[model samples]
Target chain A: MSDSVLRWTRPLAALVVIFGLWQLAGRVWTFPGYLFTPGEIARAWFASLDPETGSAVLATTLRAVAGFLIATAVALPVATVAALVRPVERILEPYIGFFFALPKISLLPLLVVWLGYSDSARITMIAVSAFFPIFVYMFAGVRGINPGYLKVASNVGASRRERFLHVVLPAVAPMAMAGVRIGVAISLIVTFAAEVVGQSPNGLGRLIQDGFSALDYDQMYAGIVMFALIGLGLDMLLRLMTRRSPGLWGEGVPA
Target chain B: MTSPSHVMSTTTVQPTALRVEEVTRTFRRKGRNVQALAPVSLSIPSGQFLTIVGPSGCGKSTLLQIMGGFDTPSTGTVTTPAGPVTGPSRDIGMVFQRATLFPWWTVEKNVAWALRCGGTGRREALQRSRELLDLVGLGGFETAYPNELSGGMQQRAALARTLSLEPSVLLMDEPFGALDAQTRELMQEELIRIRQAAGTTIVFVTHDIREAVFLGDRIVALSGSPGSIALDLAPDLPRPHTHEVMRTQEFLDAYETVWACIRDQASAREPGRSERAAEQDDQGESA
Candidate 1:
């Protein structure tokens, strides 16, 4: 088979085989209490279609995406300006490094104490976790730009605004996007952790926590499956978006 | 200037296109001042194709940048007929050694953007870009991205982008320096043709002696570090140069003269090389 053809079919074939064996084993023997059969998990997943459960899924998605966007919006401009100005960079470095080194999840309890067990606190945790990677990548991207490009921009008499929009923005876009990809992944992880540990009213993480406490292994596995699907779906969508618009990521990277 | 295309009629009294008055550059590196260029002065007439040649680290690129107003000279001034240069203007365009085309843009859009900077509207900029692309022999590659093109073709696209501004004078810093030998020669020919069509005054900097001779009406050689003009020769080569002209005696003699000038500077600086190398090592350690 061609490489492109095998790329989809091979992994898919392994998944099918694995699931078939798992179902056979579960039916033949008594598995652990936490281990639910694939059939039972599917039934639980279908049962999760009620509005309350649907809102749990929605809560998780909103938290992750909003947090990622907020981090990106803040990081890109901050990094660009910081990299361009020496005094700003010097002032920002210590703060950036300190925050980046901190475990953002540890702040969730303190934030919950301050803001209550609310979306704001959870989203803040996710946003704080997402900021560091985005900022670092963008700062390096702006700094790594070829001085020659700026010289060319000046020689052509491009004004400051035009140069930023046309030269600096496009040049640093891929770096910013890479940072965003990582940021989104971090937001998803942080959102789940914050949701579960903070004991908020509703979220996929809360649904999983409820299932575990009730000894409803099927619902727990189904919630876990939903997270995996959401992750895969998001990654596929983002990759597709970047691939579709080659102009945004095309040509060569900044020197 | 129009009557004689070959351009050695100093008696014609063409108005000065660009004048450099005792310009020098000193860069501060590692808490020490490193003088890149000594006080250098030269006057170029309108529509003249002048080439500046020197060895590496000879500060030829620095001179070109100063002329283009991309860098300020430590002292002295550069003036065009319109005004004294405070910074880069639309009247003076530049092409760097590396093609600085926005990778996101296709060949045509790159040229169009330069035109758009001059306040040309969308349709007209695209139209002018098409013409410029064709002029640079990039007729069919308009929609192709910079990465898809070869080094020579990218440089051609860069040249087209700069030319779109309709600048009266163009400053190029080793524009062909990075290309392979064959591509470099071909680009040299392309530049000669483009200069003829546009009649734009040019100051082309290169380390290659033969390239300096083949494309220039006036060749100025700068010696090693703290470089100043070592020799200025105006070889009366035939106009509308072709590749075949490379075989002519006029071309060969001009080549030899520049080659000798550069060779002499190399040996003269040979004794000071070890001292410079030690200084560089000290700078590296400090850094």
Candidate 2:
């Protein structure tokens, strides 16, 4: 076999084995109505490539992206401030701890009540869920920098702005990227959960919820497969972006 | 006692490049006061290579830090030609035992960044970085990240970065200590070449007695616990030092003298004569 084909053989074989067993169980065993056969799920997935399903995918993607952007936009500066100032960290510690500890899904009802059943409530919930992880990672990254680097910067007569731009930003970038990766997954998850629980106008989550209600197990499974693929695709995209700057990934790539 | 007028007259008679006037340092750790360095005064002339050697925990680093203006002296002053050293200045550059390069930056950028911090223009900083890299024999490795370089190469790049600021004083704390013996020797030779070319005053701190004699025009050995300078000797070795010079009798004698001074300091801390003899036996086994 060719190198590319050889590389993919293990994953492909694993997929075939798992799906074969799942299909056999679905055919022979008595299971719940929600349980779907692999063939049925594949057919439904192909069928879901219509304009209606496309719109649902777009809606969910937009909500997830928006939540991710807003979460990072607010979290970056706030985390930076908290890391630099001990008093600010003290002030925010209890609230961040409380929110981070609470189950974010439980807040969906309260968000809907406060912000109404509009897209705003769903985005807010996703943003809230995604914010803590990024903030915590960035805070730790900034705090954990080697004091030697700062000493060298000062010795070189670096100004406050220069120190932040050259030393602090690059030093903390890897950890912040790790946080962003986590935030990407959390944003997607919170968006989907909010859609199902809040019954939003259009999304993959709503499609799955409606399919389940109408006893269309195949369509629900198709939506689930799409969710997994989207999540994986976004994660891979993040990894590729970081690979371009190998230093942020702690690798010594040749120029 | 001599009046302030008499001190001023003495200071005026001979101008010093760097002066440490009774500089002392004390730290409070876990509610206990620890005196790291006692009142120490030293005056170094321009373009002199001075090395401070001591045993572990003798606060050689504390004294170096105080001299570099990275730490404040408890009740004394360090003054340069410009004025009192209150904070870190561009005139003095420091190199640590570890390379401490910003891993994210390529070799050229790391050097260039130091120049940039000193308000050099971007293009000029980069141009200067290329020249310094070449000077340090790292010209082709300009685009390589720090981790790609060998340990010796990393320290060479760090030296280039420190030199980029055009500092008149270079303070190094065991800059080649982490390298293997062969690499450390090569780095020491490379340093002598660079020092001659730059003509910067150097105050180096190391625990290695041989390294102290090899590098310093004058060696100052410090005693342990409330560290104070115990012995100050000038080796009087010829300039443009080479590997063959290490085999010379003068070099061996100088090394022996420094070793004896350090041993004496260590043995003085021992309680009894028998214990001191046992310590000497242990040293012999180690050698």
Candidate 3:
């Protein structure tokens, strides 16, 4: 195998070894009282994914996705407008900084009181948490385009729209990707936090909360593991997407 | 006084290529005005290769920058076919001291981008870029990135990118100055060949006397501090001037004359211009 493949193989082997140990610690060792194996977690995961009955797993994924999409939709336009206009950017800058400084978890009670203890409060919390990082990343990307690139556009007699489409937007795409990755992380974190605080009807966070309440340690660990794995998957998908966009991340970064 | 309208008429009547009239540059550094170039005037006819040679900090690069419309002179004006050089014009292509290729682009893409900017379709641009890359002896390396290429190759790609525009006036600021001696010579010959083929009126800036003499139809020698044209040496050497021309007695004579002029200016600029003048006065009286 090539050197790159060899490097990957070593990491893959280490991962397998770690999982094998985890399985041994849980199953083969026969540690009783809520200590379940990977097989048990898998079985539970499959059992909780029935579409007709609306599984706990499905509800969890849906809630997170819904919150993420809402946050991104609102944040993207706000951040873009803030980046473009100087006065607006100044007006929003202090507010954004203050909000980012304030912990979203601390505002859970206020969010519940205003939006109620339903999915609305949970989603609002998730959006609030996810929104800032995306806003920051998007703004930085837009502002970071070199003056020289704009000069190039002007020299070439490009119209304002042409310059934006060709140079400005393309230059900011990498930074936008960076923002998206950060947003994804925030989305997952806030999703879990929301479930814990608001106790949303369906979600991994709810499952974990219920498991912990009942002292079902294995179920809580399984939910935690599932959350981490999904987040990792999301990050990988974003990385691949960024790599594919030639106009943005193609420079210096290896395929 | 040449009427601006008359100048504009003659230039507009037919592409005048490039013209700088009494173009002086001044800088307000630390609340004091330093005149880099005194009022200097020159006209470059189309298809003529004009090289400006001067000592370090002689504002040769400054003059080139003014001509390329990269900087504005404090006083006087520059007139080109594409109106007053208020900003960088597509009709004028400029290559700086360093190759500033977008690191994200492949060598082919970098060259192709110039054409893409010029409104050519991507397919056609890619084809033209490949031919241009081949012209610069970067053939078969289209897929290679800028980082993969050597310094000389990178400069050549930069040259290719500038030429891809097919601009009427090509402004190069020491394009080959950063290379090894052998590479510089080879690149200079390649540039001459390319300029001849493209019929580009080039304003090449250099500190090397031989390189200037080898390349330019007319060499504009600039002086320091308040940079002004000290000499405009027109080499009437026979056509198809090659590297061998540098070995000729005529070439050597011209080099020596240009060197003497540059050396005097360098010394004058070293110890304040006033002190140099005083020293000159003492030597004159003693003689």
Candidate 4:
């Protein structure tokens, strides 16, 4: 009980100290137009809570989640196929390295030209940005399964489908989940980036962009704060899910 | 340590459960052919406990893997009563050195998973797994994840999973080798009890001679550069084995015989083993 209390209190204390110091500093100095006190940011967030914040939150969430799901759907099967068939791995080898090294954000213009400055382009951009991390982790996960596991599967006379579903799926789940966590975070980042630079008309990215243009520092801070909160919420949700589920952990000995 | 039946699994007139005919294993490593095991032939009778003992470099584990059809012999065949061993089957279950229990699952789920592979329904399989867990002394640990359990408990869960298949033969490759001494001893006793209840033929592989003498009705010792059976003894030790049995004259004599055979192998160099090939064999993957 004490440990759990301490867990929250320590981080909360640190955050309070940082924010309090920032607020005090703002009061002592004549700040620039682009900067706002933490108090002013909170007031701005409350004022925009109804339509502005809600719509932006919804738009950003939809794009990020859709892109994350799409990326997972593609990366998982591709990784499995690569693990199962040696030739597929050989074929994907060069491209996996090349695409991983290349910055995915640079493809936004090409995507904009192909799909237009719409949600589709933004969603596609998020997925493209998220795919490499998911694929890299998932590929490593699938390839690194213990040979003993497959031996046990066959020894039990499991059919091909059963082996895939029971052994392969569960064995890769922990690592895949790790990939999904990173992918989800990447998805939100890409969504914000796509919205901001690509000049999307909606989303938290747009709110920040508009705030910057109007010299409303509080609004920009509010948008940034909301983005951070959403990221924290999603991460907490994923963590809660892993803890509740039994099999999505480090396989006893990484075997 | 004993449960009930097959306490002495008398060697004579018992039908053969597993027959390995002149089996040899050769591994091709970096364009060089490495012979892991020389010709090995053994006939294991039904419901008997057969332990294969050897030094670390010996192909005891390789031989056990072949018995389970996890690996194929380079030059021979392993036959069971059903047919020649061509592939892994539920009839021949295997328990590995590492517990290898799926970390994502509870103990019950891990055991039920094996039954599920054999087309059992989920609820029924889970109920049956409870019974198997009870048999392995994990009665209340059904909902516990593998990681939550100790090394011994994990092995118990693993054994329960293997037993869920109701295999005719159990091929164990150093299942208790990773456990501490006390846990290893405890598992050994539990294994004897479990084997009695299960009444399946078991081919357990380990490098411990004392373990072999304690557990097996028949013991096969493999040692030296390339693996071959150095000693095969059927000791008439006390049944319903306990630690006290280890102090018996019969047990001591059997242990002495097997130890002598292995000691001689290490002391004297075998013929046709070039120093380079022997070094490669020592560092080879088979063990």
Writing each residue's lDDT as its tens digit, candidate 4 over B104-183 gives: 77899889989988999989999999999999999989999888999999999999999999888898888998899999
Task: Tell me what TM-score chain A of model 3 achieves.
Answer: 0.84
Interface RMSD, in order shown: 1.6, 2.3, 3.1, 1.9
Q: Compare the candidates by lDDT and give the number of the best one.
A: 4
Instruction: Specify the poorest-scoring 10-residue window by lDDT in model 4 chain A.
Output: A246-255
Model 4 docking tier (incorrect/acceptable/medium/high): medium
The positional error of residue B203 in candidate 1, measured at the CA in angstroms, is 0.9
lDDT of 3 at A36: 67
Report residue A100 deviation for candidate 3 (angstroms): 4.0
TM-score of 2: 0.88
lDDT of 3 by residue, A1-255 (tens): 599999999999998898788887885576676766666777665654545224655666677778778878988778888988999999998999899889877888898999889888887787788888888988887777665555556555566786777677767777777777788888888888888888687778888888899997756776777787778887897788777645456355322
DockQ of each: 0.63, 0.46, 0.21, 0.59
* Model 1: colliding residue pairs: none
- The lDDT of each candidate is 0.85, 0.85, 0.77, 0.86
Sorted on TM-score, best first, the list reads 4, 1, 2, 3
Query: Fnat per model, in the order given?
Result: 0.66, 0.72, 0.30, 0.83
What is the fnat of model 4 with respect to the true interface contacts?
0.83
Instruction: List candidate 1 stretches off by more than 4 Å.
Output: A1-7, A10-44, A47-49, A240-244, B1-11, B270-287
Off by over 4 Å in 3: A19-55, A70-89, A146-148, A243-248, A253-255, B1-16, B24-40, B53-59, B98-113, B116-127, B142-148, B177-182, B207-213, B221-227, B235-239, B245-287
Pick the winner on TM-score between candidates 3 and 4.
4
